[model samples]
Target chain A: MRAHNLALVLDTVATSADPPSRASVAAATGLTRATVSALVDDLIAGGLLTELDPPPRTGAGRPAAGLALTSAGPAGLGCEINVDYLAACVVDLTGTVRQHLVEHADQRPAAAAAALAALGRLAARARLAAEADGLVMAGAALAVPGLVSAGTVLDAPNLGWRDVDASALLRGVPELADLPVVVDNEANLAALGELRVPGAEQTFLYVSGEIGIGAGLVIDGELYRGVRGWSGEIGHVTIYPDGRPCRCGATGCLEQYAGQEALAAGEPRAAAALGIALSAAVNLLDVPVVVLGGAYATYFDRLRDGIEAELRRRVLTAGLAPVTLRAARLGTNAAVRGAADAVVREVRDDPAAWLRRVG
Target chain B: MRAHNLALVLDTVATSADPPSRASVAAATGLTRATVSALVDDLIAGGLLTELDPPPRTGAGRPAAGLALTSAGPAGLGCEINVDYLAACVVDLTGTVRQHLVEHADQRPAAAAAALAALGRLAARARLAAEADGLVMAGAALAVPGLVSAGTVLDAPNLGWRDVDASALLRGVPELADLPVVVDNEANLAALGELRVPGAEQTFLYVSGEIGIGAGLVIDGELYRGVRGWSGEIGHVTIYPDGRPCRCGATGCLEQYAGQEALAAGEPRAAAALGIALSAAVNLLDVPVVVLGGAYATYFDRLRDGIEAELRRRVLTAGLAPVTLRAARLGTNAAVRGAADAVVREVRDDPAAWLRRVG
Candidate 1:
């Protein structure tokens, strides 16, 4: 009960638009002022929270000290392994990115071990930079463009990889071996990153367009990972059904028409195909918004009209509730940032665990 | 807390495979035997439960009496409005059907009021029959093949219903005015009905193939009703962009190829189109099972091969975790039974509410 109350108090302070005084948190959470103060003290002692300087007195005897998440305590290390790039970032407890690094390379030709080793080096650099800024690394998460489950990449056709043990590969790097790591699909992570946008909807589909198109389904503020963690394979959704054969042994998959290669080749039907596929998602899932990320964000100006035209015509609820479409605010950085945010969230969700570990 | 404990105890008995003794329920729920006995007594007095005769014992001094839900109280009234049929049924608390009636007629040309009036009369007959069987009508639920929200049928294309105030129409019928009613999409209700099947997967996509194609997504034992209750419009999912025009003002919709009319016309591409559209759903939603209901159940053997082939070929995780396909167990009766079941569930879930009302 104490742990739960501590987390509740911390979350209250973290999510408040303005720093909240202990009394305000007590009122908001329905906890007594004494209980709130005790919980806040524990959080402050654990370095999970800090009391902000009191505001200048206007007409009162003394202004209350506002509470906020500590920025200089713990941070998250995020790494990304894509077909063409490796990136890493460090995010602080206050949801601020402290360090970011991107390396442009054709990772498709590299072995899984080599790719992970490079990512390890980049993550090490980001970690050192964060440490220099008085932040300790809490944990790490890796984003891969593939079907990831239990720290293994089941398949990434674009990277010519399958069943790669990502955790073992990362463990080989001495700098990353001690850091706890979680692996997830890049699109899923990107969706989580977009979820942190100030005014984003709690439920929407986040489409990641790249060499292979993938999607992340955010339902009621949580990523819907599906039964086996292989949901949102929108790239493989049938578009033409017979127009073009796909490497996945499927005919006329959406990727064949609207993937990065197709869009680069200026495929005339890419926008229409995307619209058709998204319409199916919206109709079936009733997700009211679609966030276009990755290459789609880059080409949103060109694709928006064609996609909207098809959506208006194909969606059943268009007249009553139009599906909103928008570009990814974080653009190419969503996946890495989302990975870091996930680690930060883990610490915020269970500060007791972090406190116990540190103690 | 008492009401919650009452519902929990009732649900435990209701879902138990066999009638359980009060001692067994106490053990299962971690409540004291005295508490269980008191709750059971209240439930028995409220006509929600009954004590079964003890089984003959050889070694024991006394065999404990078993508890079961009462069959003679709080019956549910279910009605379905479809393009070709109007059906009503009464289901007792124990889930036994006491009465059922179906009228086959083309309802598209009839005004919504005329059609609902006929349904009200049918429901009244079923209710009277249930009353003769010693059951009291608790409430009613009506299922329609269209978009329903707030007791209004918004756009049932096959039935030519748009913005029809279903509650108002039913209220005009004195027989049903006094009964509490809920309006739901037929496919959603049918999926709920199928959820009651023993050993059924809690998450699956139920496709209802009538004159129009609608789908119900069940996730984690609950229906995934989208924002505004407009979800699972599988009929509008684009199949072959620009292939064929549809009455919903869309081109290449799955309904254009796999609807009941298309199958009746022996459309050669019906099976293939169904496979493609279902593949898209499986890919995006990652629902591991697909239950074909309505017309699709009748043609399951013919459509299974084509749909499975496409799912295996198109779904990204088909090799590792193949999507399972099955036919609806209840067949055409699923929607009406599900509607009735919904009402019965309401009573079972909150027996205290009913007891208060009756008192």
Candidate 2:
């Protein structure tokens, strides 16, 4: 029953365009009026939902009460750190974006602290705004342009950061310290972001941009985190055995040939590997829909056709369902929006009590 | 209560190595004796289960009646076609293997008729065995080694066939015409086989070995069939752009690179590409567990270190749970076993009269 109710509520809110009333919930779910009231009450007590004012109906004898996200409830903050800038957003229990902020930065490791400080201030403002709007932050997630292991940024060659401790950096902000701050590769988060986008539950892949390329795979609506959390890293797939030197000390890594800066600035000859490399990845994964996002999405089309052609030649299945390649709907805000969504998942799913008391 | 009773019967049977008595089923599922009796009646009425003689307990007053899967019920077949051979196995409703058969054939499309004849002969033998034991045949499934879409094999490089009508192939056997037949990629069936493996629910990436290499993916215990039904075609990922031309007219696809024949022939360079390509794939998916079966599992040790190192280069987040890379327990039988298991899934989850009807 608990699982069923959770599914019903989450499914309802996720599918509905706007907040609904108890009567609607009952009507859609086919539960009794009393059952709807009981479920709604439980959800309210659990702090996973709120009551909103319903719009007046033309022929209604009595006005229905509305339910929506509460402003003073717990919230989540998600920050997407790209190659040259950062974007952040805060969300409440109902998946509402309360605040979004972006900042620019240098790629040097030395600039990381200053950028972190700026991020701290931006997060402080978001928390304050969330509080003003009656939502308290329950958690925050930080996505970076590198390989992250636990709280440490192990290797972000593009940023020149070697084993940078992102969790420690976020810890400097007292307002964000106590919350469970998650940090991972920006691409992985973008993949999740794309998967959560409306109507992305089937098989889909996300190609995230920034310093390097990262792919996120979702099969049947579940994230495919390969052994060791490195399932979608296509940038370093060794496109040329004798290609340009990769930051990871390997020649011919896909990043050297197709990475954002590499593809953007390198001669077209260098970009020739994009088709072969991406086709290699696509053929292996067999994802029907591929969404390109990140700082490099716009520029990626320069090589998209070649990759698709190569895929046509190499994929085992001919006449495959046309792989829909589209720009991400969330665009530049994919990571931040996805970050806020993680909180939405938590609060909506009924997390720890204190954390559960959300918008 | 109905659902609970159904789960009880299934769970009890799943847990028991040998058949259990009705009283034992009642105790195991926490149901009243009357309820257990009533449910068993329903189960027998559906063809899914039957009664059997219990193994005598040393000091028992009287032997308890053993409840077991009905051999007279519906069955599913997993037929595998490789470069030069065809194999089929019949599975009972409980997912138990009842019969297995195989034959060799030329890769020529013209030989499809001969292969169909072989299948008909095998089916006849299987039917004879089932009738000798008083069992009823239910359904059959075919696992093709190629790019299958909508009941057709569009291309199977190993088999050197294209656009072969798989659904029509079964018509060669008149007895099978009345039965439901399913056809899918062999690799996909292998992945389902892994999902049905006892005590395992983690994501599974099943790679099969026969003539050429193929792969299957299972995420969250469900087969991840891409939109075109062409997902899990890892063999065709072009790892080499300008290298050796493959049968598919592509250079450096995983199959052309590390396929069974390629690896067996000592394609040192191709073997190297195998590890790197898989490493890149695993890292990109963020799936912590990878079950390596089929062609690659034999030389897994050769590919392990390189794949792991390459994976480390691409993976971003480091989670505490270590990614598990293990060989499949079912060995070459995974698909046949999985075909049987698929029948169990359909029978157990839906209102199937075939499963419930008893003689």
DockQ of 1: 0.81
TM-score of chain B of 1: 0.96
Per-residue lDDT of model 2, residues B260-347, tens digit only: 7777787776545755666555655656666777666677777667656544543333333345667777777677667656755666
Q: Give per-residue CA lDDT, model 1, range A1-359, as digits (tens).
A: 88788789889998899999999999999999999988888788878898889888889588899899999988999999888789999999999999999998989878888999999999988998899888989999999988988999999888888999987787677877888999999999999999987788899899999888899999889999887788899999898877798878888999999998899999999999999999998889888999999889999999999999999999998878888999999898899999999999999999889888886
Candidate 2 chain B least-lDDT 10 residues: B313-322
Query: TM-score of model 1, chain A?
Result: 0.95
The digit string of per-residue lDDT tens for model 2 on A1-359 reads 75566557656754677778788887888878788787677666656567776567778477777766555566788876667776778877656688988877654655677667667777777777777876767788888877777878877777777777887787688777777888887777777777776676566778776668777777678776654565677777767665677776666777776666766685464445655655666666666677778755666567567666755666554354555667787776777788777766766665444433442
Worst 10 residues of 2 chain A by lDDT: A350-359
Q: Model 2: which docking level applies?
A: acceptable
Off by over 4 Å in 1: A21-42, A51-66, B30-35, B53-64
Q: After superposition, how far is residue A13 of candidate 1 from its true place, in Å?
A: 2.4
Model 1 interface Cα RMSD in Å: 0.8
